[model samples]
Target chain A: MKSTLIIVALLLMLGGCKSTGGPTLYQQLDGKAGIERLIDSFINQIARDEKIIHYFEDANITHFRDGFINHLCALTDGPCEYIGDDMVAIHTGMNINETDFNHVVELLINAMNELNINHTVQNKVLAKMAPLRAEIIEI
Target chain B: MSMLKFFLGFIACLLPFSNFAGQGKLLATPGVSQVEGSAGGGLVPWAQLAGYATDDEFAINGFCSRADVSDYTLDVCGAQINLFNRVEFSYAEQHFDVPALNTKIEQSITGAKIRLYGDIVYSQWPQLSLGVQHKSLRDGAVATLVGAEKTSGTDIYLAASKLHLGALAGYNWFWNMTTRYSEANQLGLLGYGGANSRQKLLFEGSTAIFLSRDIAVGIEYRQKSNNLGLGEEDWRDVFVAWMPNKYVSVTAAWLDLGSIAGADDQTGWYLSVTGYW
Candidate 1:
């Protein structure tokens, strides 16, 4: 009976490790708290990218942070609606470059990692925000 | 014919990269390699005078200019552009003089920047690119290599960039190092290939700091090895750029370039303009 119980436990662990792809991503990151936690971590990292922190000198520190969260929440099919400045208007004079943009993207991915979000879930989120490049960078 | 075909094949590989990597924002600069930054929706460098990459991968940009050197003599300028992203293709030429000196020279540079990794428009951060530049002067004696003659010099660099804030704000940053050799021992005749093709490595960087609806400021720094096969030199600059709307952009800057070759350091102001449609 002991061996039988051990075998059952092993099988359950194996099942848990299986790749359920999309369903697993949804299960891991679908909730509101999960989304909020992810956004919180992302902003914290951006604040720390010392090389670029100076650009935000004029940004409404707290407001920008919450605005980004709301912007993201609405993007991932969440209930929040983004009520921030239009992309072009907000970034009018900022001379953004690829390195800055990619670095921020990396911080975001790291944020997801801290939240224990899976790769598939992360990719899904990136895909939704990828098109925003047009609005974010000044060409 | 074989060489031509080989060259064509080489060019085909570098196309679409311009589609995703072009700075659509920045313009050509005399300083460090430009970082990967976005120009909102276009594929152009922010500070460069011409676009390295267009919406398509394959593209060519050319320009000619004439500057008054102080008297009856006029200087003619020419630069070539060819690109596709992964691999780079470029040509630059210059021939100007102080007619009173009865002397003139010319130079040219050919180089490439490769695409390594990262998202083209991920938004959260800038685009990333790593590549090498092999620039050199053409076949000309020191006294005759006037204006914009080709240079026989090479440099390597790493670049990362992005676009931000839409029309309200944006910035592009990059770092690079260049090596210059003295020709026949003349310091002013250094940029183009000089004396047995000396090799000097430099550290350079530039940033286009934007603020407001259509105004921007830029800062640049370039450090170089001053060896006719010898040592090093240093230089730095500050600039202000204007983009009244989205179609036209202009930049004027002040420079501090201790010296080059045997020529006295030509530190002064520079102006550049661009119209995008």
Candidate 2:
């Protein structure tokens, strides 16, 4: 029983440690320039990925680049507001399945690896973006 | 040997599907295969299916495991098919060497699992699954000598699993709980039931912390029933698994099975490898 209590206390401590007032995610990501570099790397990754490349064939690359960088900046609490199209509106009619969406996520992870992003920061970024799956897929 | 030929044939059969092989789930999301041929830790079945298939894809996996303890050694080989990440079918052949008895026992298990609801990572609730395993003993002399009632039995289980991203000190945490109803004695190697002959509810659990995206260290506990009036015991293990990619994984564990049949302190080392396609 004493061991069980210790385990429970440890779990409670771990559970309570979510996102306290340390460095903001934006600062940890090195601010706007870092996000832009990430987006450029992500775009390059998507370009090389054949499985999901066709989805961008008719896309406006410059517009997408700017919108995505702004989106990331806003998502990460950087000093930016995304005045772009909604995620649902942008992904509608593309019929992107879960496989393709996950493929894109993998490509982004590859990009992050190439940039030598810390694993913890990458997980935070993915967590911030994961909820958008509902808005972006199977619509 | 014939087993090698059969394994080669199995690979040949999978060749046709290689062009459309599905790896839809994130790497290492689908847990490694268990001893009973289910997607789980080395000892306990988790709620996840066996391969990297999502709702729109299918996957196949093959695995082999061996546990060598003080008085016994268990070798198992199996294959699993995951359809749409919703259902799984598996088959496993087990060979048990009982050095004390100067004999060997063999059993085959056929298993099926269905995902009832939720996703391990994306859902608010834990992923739930229902599963069944039908075990048949190929050699029943030891079972009969132990006063077993039957050489075959079925186990039904309900399992729930969840993966918490960055939940444990910036690493991923995964946990699973399974409740099973069975009358199998020593996983049916000693056959099913006995004079006691009552089915009992059992509990199994596993928890793991992913040090990296590709590696996990975990512990598992499984409660067992002494249906045959033998001093069967609960099982526990500490395991480390490495999934370098979605296509392959390796696991090693130190097991403390307490006792089996009549032998006490049945501790061992276990190693397993799984290949996904």
Candidate 3:
């Protein structure tokens, strides 16, 4: 009975090992479905944020949502390609200031909180997105 | 403490009028006011300016701190103004009580700082800043008795700070390093320069890990110049800070000041509160 129990524990451990080999950041964000939900939440947050709503008044929500999903998916190593316009190209004429940019980040964080995303995962996502500030701001 | 109350009351009065105030930076990014009224940990000043003002905004802040050791008690209260997130100006009054001497020492510090480069979180490099503090001793009798040369002095410092996301076991890691040149003894409370009449370059450092969005635990080390040679040892502290939001922050620390005025093993507890506008 002891040998059988040990074998059973070994099998369970082996099963866990298969999933732990390397879960990409994309998988940690719960893959495509999770990304969609996050984008939807972000949209709702932006829609209500009066401080930055003006900047998006002319935006095509469907296109922006699709592009953001793809961008985040590719950035996090998901099985997707973001072939849309580069960050600089898309943000050049917007002339977003530092405060507005930071406000957007705050709104995104709030959206993630509403989704019950863990802090560690949220931090990872922000880290991946932070580098885009240079390409998106003051243009 | 009446002055401290007045400052807190002043901040409270401004709260209703500050609809656009504190909306620029992320919450808890400005840090709490240090002992000397600069934005930093309890003992060391950081590169970030005080308050949550961005390039297009301005903010004001008030803070009070108390430190109680085995032999003495130090009380400080101050106010700060941040302009466009670029410059900071501060004024603080300090009172130190010594029951053994049955007397109190008083001093005031005026400080100004300017940001030179980068941002704490968004930039590729650490933020850099330059600061200056002018200190004046209100009670100079003790300084004269201790063989100090002057009752006033100026300190100049350069500081750099950065925050790394998910760097410490999935928590945010923040760090600051500062170098100062000064001749102040016990931060000018005991006066400036004693046996050593010249200013010395000193190093200070602070590091913290954000356990969550609203809390940070940290440590700080400040190298002191023993101009008085009264066994004026270095200062170090371990601290925990709680910022429920941008409106207020409270910090508590365990301080090890080593030695001061010929006394040794001066360990203590410190508590501080900062209110934002």
Candidate 4:
């Protein structure tokens, strides 16, 4: 096809971008199971402490958990729609202070350690979530 | 004993999901490189610079070392571990709410980008990627949002970056030009029957620079369309990152300045840490 040549020509012009050290070092991990297990690990880390989980007293654990997972999956361009609650609605009245939100974030790091996930994927997810800090913390 | 069992069992169950987005993945993004800092992107480039797909890697590996007028914020959290591979995907959610006024708002970002070969600096013949950061807004408190409530919109962008071998040479950059192609949900749009949404388009750009192998820096300037009525919006930051080891990275940044809704003009800080399996 003419388009194929254009594509090949473009690749030649741009150097056809290839890896230097070895074959691709990464692959798309399994979707659902991988994401849910991560959520559990993350939530459990936050739940162990009374400070952060305390805010969830009036909140439903399942609802909150599902929301967290869906939101994360959607953010990563996964094929899912986050449906539990609106971003602001869930955080409303919960009064998630910067400290609380941040502590949980710490727990999240620990969870990753326990899971032994690679460092690169970890940063990819965190980068996706960083921009939301302003709205979630209100501070 | 049951508690201990539960804890152990939990980790066991999660072990299989090892490769998902965990601490290690977060460690790579430039800004917020650490888990306990206040700076958003002091030493890294913004996530937007990654060109939508969260896993795009240009040919450069260095820390960003820049300061935002508000706080030194690094943006590049990281490049994908998959090499300069093919693929792209991204999504975002924006929220607007005024508790006192009992109003609410929301927005979504859907992005996808693919790499273009050859380096920005051409040393390693870095990869280049083109993507879009679409913004979809829905709200009910537009008038009270402290600024214009451009309901829904999306932006297209082109990004090119490179990675150098050592301490002295490297640079990364990303630019986004989004058009306001949807409704400007006024946050109070309680279904005003049939109000037509306006057509307002805007252009914005962001860039990141590297100063050393483990340290990097950058800044972003976004020119808002005249539609928002806020004239122009600015977000500038500089950050420093410490990659003691590839397994972990710590970053701190100072971000100063403003946005559409407005910041206190106060300096802000961010700390981040990322690691992997």
Candidate 5:
């Protein structure tokens, strides 16, 4: 009976010590404004990366930036709705290969690193983006 | 010596003298090469492919490994290719030396692995693969003297692997489990089966914690069958691997091979160097 009580007490203590108020990804990325800046920097990196620049030659920079920011904000649980086209619809017939996709991911990681984003947050963001490879690569 | 010259030439060929341009795939995902020529931890095989190849690409890798124990020494050299991130074909040659017995054992292994389902990364489910290895021993007379049933055998295995990114305080965690059916003794160095001539099912498991993008530390446990009643026990190891770049990786481990051929508590150090493209 005493051991059971001790276990119950320990559980309560553990629960009490648990961190429930840690900053969310949205706040860690500094909300919509910071997301906008990240997208801007990411676009610049993509524009300069020769391996991926050709894919964006015909893209509309302003529209792509807006859509990307909104998508990123929504993905990070910010107060925004992604109004862009679905991944499959947007990438169909683009002939984007795995090499291109990985290059873009690398550029994004570089952008995040330049912005001093924490590694954990960077991985979380990348994990969210990784699933889109099915719809975007050679689809 | 010729062996040392070969080793040096291998390293020179794998050296990152010039960057190969336009390579895709994530870093360190394919993992370092195992002694058996598969992509995995130091001693055990994982379900991952052998190189930095994605679904639409192919890659090739080569490695050499050496293990020094209290009673014996082992050297392995092998190569493998990953096709479209799905299938892997490998070949390895192993040399075992027992100084006390003034004898040497040599074996050649051909292996193949096919990915069945899931992804190592970017998926909730673990990646699973099926593998087969055919081993042939060079010294048939020595094998028979050791009470082996055959000088050649096959091992079939199913392995599952998963990586949990940022699961532990911003660090990645890797897990793998393999089930194997085999009749080989001492991984086919002493040859197939034994006096009992029975194939047995065994289990192997590995878990790792990633310290960074390029470094990981892990532990492995492998169960073995004692068909000959030679007091062969299970194997275990603690290992650390470093992939400084996509082209090169190195692993070091402390391994326990239990008792082998009357040698008890056979503990050792294992080192391997790998190159991938």
Candidate 6:
């Protein structure tokens, strides 16, 4: 009986580990069109957020949008490769603090919520984006 | 009187409505309230501070937890405050009811935590914190009869926690490790020390994978010192926490507390609810 219980517990743990067996995140996010929509929503929300909007005052909206979409696509294992400059190079002079970085993340979260993105998918994206804090936060 | 003091402090913290409000960055990163009134899992304290305090903000959190084991029932209620996202102060009232013996033991615990270094999500190094809990038994007579060494004791602990984003196929993973020096049996409800009165070092660890931005499932194991010789054993649990939003969160767990007061296999259901501002 004890061995059986141990086996059952192991099975439960294994079941939880199967999250990686599904489709790639790019496909799960509905490919290019979905990526485009997500980026559009995110950019719109960032524009409305006064906390971080000043950072984008001199940014070219159309160029930034395309570069961001391509960056996200490449990060999620999509077919497209990002052509823009690396994150560190682009954000080096921004003088972003932890508070500013967090504010942008909050806007991204709001955008994801508005797009009705699954919470798990949202976290997946955020997880990939989290490491960029070190590169982006200059101050 | 201690209980009254705890309640008064809780009420005072709640009265500062403007100071206790606002949200922080990240989801499911600042752990919820643990059973002992610290920010952590149900049984073990994690390194993260409680509430939604950002760099320049203060926040408050309140929680209640109940666990129904085979031989006893335990209830805990507490409130915690985060100061400038650096320090935390908490107070909790605990009651342990053993229906078979028709007896109850009450305890009041005051806890403080200081974030020494690192950020949970932003830093490469694990966030480290130092914590201390001062516990005093209200039912001193009953506790002494159970071979308890002292009615009051202090527990000191150091905890480290880290968040590894995209560690598991894009999912976020959280890990925590804590080292505690104490002689408390059953988390000071049955009092501190006893036959083996020497303080011992104990380890507690927790790891969780984010199923979503607002949901996490994890397991925790806490090693205990059997100082009282009442067959105290290690504690283990598998828990799932759901944070619907910043203001509210709930957790449910299947806990196995090994043994307590000679009652073996004390397994049960644990549930906790938390409200933050």
Clashing pairs in 2: none
Q: What tens-digit string does per-residue lDDT give for candidate 1 at B1-277?
A: 2332344344445443434434432223211112111121111122222343433333333233332212322222222232433444444344545465575654443445454444333335544554443433343464334332233544445555543322111122222222222232222333443344444444344444344324556555554443343323455556666666433455556655554444455566545444332
Which DockQ values do the candidates obtain, in the order shown? 0.05, 0.50, 0.29, 0.02, 0.30, 0.31
Best by DockQ: 2
What i-RMS does each candidate reach, in Å? 18.9, 2.3, 12.3, 13.6, 7.7, 5.6
Ranked by TM-score from best down, the candidates are 2, 3, 5, 6, 1, 4
Question: Which order, best to worst by DockQ?
Answer: 2, 6, 5, 3, 1, 4
Question: Model 1: runs farther than 4 Å from truth?
Answer: A1-139, B1-60, B63-88, B96-100, B119-126, B130-139, B143-151, B162-188, B191-199, B229-232, B244-248, B261-265, B275-277
What tens digits encode model 3's per-residue C-alpha lDDT throughout B69-143?
989999999998888899998888899999999999998888999999999999999999999999888879999
- lDDT for B196 in candidate 2 is 71
Which RMSD values do the candidates have, in order?
18.3, 2.4, 8.1, 21.0, 5.6, 3.9
> CA lDDT, every prediction?
0.45, 0.87, 0.87, 0.42, 0.80, 0.83
Model 6 DockQ class: acceptable
In terms of lDDT, which candidate is stronger, 2 or 6? 2
Cα lDDT of candidate 4 equals 0.42
Best by TM-score: 2
lDDT of 1 by residue, A16-124 (tens): 5535344433345766677668777887887888956877888886787677777777776566788977877877788776446655776787788888775545655
Q: Please give the RMSD of candidate 5 to the true structure.
A: 5.6
Residue B134 local lDDT, model 5: 86
Say which prediction, candidate 4 or candidate 6, comes out ahead on TM-score. 6
> Candidate 4 - CAPRI tier?
incorrect
- Model 5 Cα lDDT, one tens digit per residue, B172-192: 767788899988888888777
TM-score of each: 0.46, 0.93, 0.91, 0.39, 0.87, 0.85
Give the C-alpha lDDT of model 3. Answer: 0.87
Model 4, span A1-139: residue lDDT tens: 2332353345344333433443222222247677788889987887788767777777778977788778877876678776767667666666665435645665776776678765445544554565576566542
Global Cα lDDT for candidate 1: 0.45
For residue B173, model 5's alpha carbon misses the true position, in angstroms, by 1.9
lDDT of 2 by residue, A16-70 (tens): 7877788777888889888889999999999998888899999999999999999
Docking class of 5: acceptable
